[model samples]
Target: MLHVTTYYDTLKVTRDAPAIVIQAACRALMQLNHPDNFEGREYEAVKIAEDLREAFDVLIDPNTRAQYDNWLAKQMEQSN
Candidate 1:
């Protein structure tokens, strides 16, 4: 499984950021990286857009977010 930190970074947010912040970050990332944002790099743009959607999906769901948060805390504990 991908680390929660990895997911948070995918959405460009801090681990402790609130759900609303996560949602806002996801929206910002989508708007910035959306396929339409890259007029020339269509292929790369599509890939970015897909990644954005996946990140948003995982972070936006409460259950998944809780799981991610738990995993993240565990990782941090292990790291220290």
Candidate 2:
């Protein structure tokens, strides 16, 4: 089985996490992966930060989040 990465996983939050929890998770992840914190791996850190930002963008909005949630549910069902 292929393990697909979801926005919830990117933010390190549960699928049913609240908006505030998602927000906090995104902030914490970005801070942890900040380019300034990794001198040698700065490029890797930037890429990770970009992914986190994308996850945050989708999960932060109500309409998009609902759409994503539906899509994620189908993905899970297929994976099973």
In model 1, which range of ten residues has the least summed lDDT?
1-10
Q: Candidate 2: lDDT of 31?
A: 87
Candidate 2 — what's its lDDT?
A: 0.92
Q: Write the per-residue lDDT of candidate 2 for residues 1-80, one digit (tens) a residue.
A: 89889998999999889999999999998888888899998899989989999999999999999999899889889889
Measure candidate 1: CA RMSD.
3.7
lDDT of each: 0.80, 0.92
Per-residue lDDT for 2-74 in model 1, tens only? 4443787888887678879988988888788777778888899788778877877878888998887798778
Which portions of model 1 miss their true places by more than 4 Å?
Answer: 1-5, 71-80
Which residue pairs does candidate 2 place in steric collision?
A: none
In model 1, residue pairs whose N, Cα or C atoms come closer than 3 Å (at least 3 residues apart or on different chains), thus clashing, are none
What is the Cα-based TM-score of model 2?
0.89
